[model samples]
Target: MEQPVHHFSELFEQLGLPSDAASIERFISRNSPLPPNMSLSEAPCWNEGQAELLREAVQEDADWAEVVDHLDASMHKQQ
Candidate 1:
């Protein structure tokens, strides 16, 4: 279940910049490290590491349950 890759084309359009892979990568890596135990749904507040890891987990193209387990962002302790 490969997730469709996300591009920042629309964001670039809105912000009026020429967005590309390098641009997106630079933008992401520019962020600060995030803390563990923080809710990812409230990301940007999350450390850069956590946010990037979460993004990787998502882009891995696994099932949602598998992604949750890997990222440990489960809504339930066990579900």
Candidate 2:
């Protein structure tokens, strides 16, 4: 069986975003705590390609699932 990679940098790369420390921190802070009631797919922060990759990662239970799930939850948390 194939093992899933659980690295945050891996997830960032999969999403076509920068995986460097500063870039990762900036991405998380900018996109998280998304607008109230906004789903991950509905967040205005993601480009179409990024959003599609995220949706696939969550729905497919892919290697990036854990990070994507965390992101989804974090984005939905109440302000």
Candidate 3:
């Protein structure tokens, strides 16, 4: 069976965040360059539930992992 594919907006929606393209861009811009030593799930921007969901997605390598990783990469990018 194939795992479901996920998108950045879907990941954001899953985390109860604004999922529009512009909102996602603004969010990434505001929070980009996450500390090199920090994990996305540990970012202060996330609520406990959101953080847990991120952690689980990564730890389990779930269907959400691709988009989660994308978000992490986007945040770590230099402006």
Q: Is candidate 1 or candidate 3 better by TM-score?
A: 3
lDDT of each: 0.43, 0.78, 0.92
* Candidate order (lDDT): 3, 2, 1
State the lDDT of candidate 2 residue by residue for 1-79, as single tens digits.
9866577777778778899888977776776778766678778888899888888887887877788887777667654
Error of 1 at 41 (Å): 2.6
* Clashes per candidate, residues 3 or more apart or on different chains: 4, 0, 0
Which is the better candidate, 1 or 3, if ranked by lDDT? 3
Regions of candidate 2 where Cα sits further than 4 Å from its true position = 76-79
Mind giving the per-residue lDDT tens digits that candidate 3 earns over 1-68?
99999888999899899999999999989987898889999998899999999999999999999999
Q: Please provide, for model 1 over 7-41, each residue's C-alpha lDDT reduced to its tens digit, 9 standing for 90 to 100.
A: 34443333344467576445444532334554543
Clashing pairs in 3: none
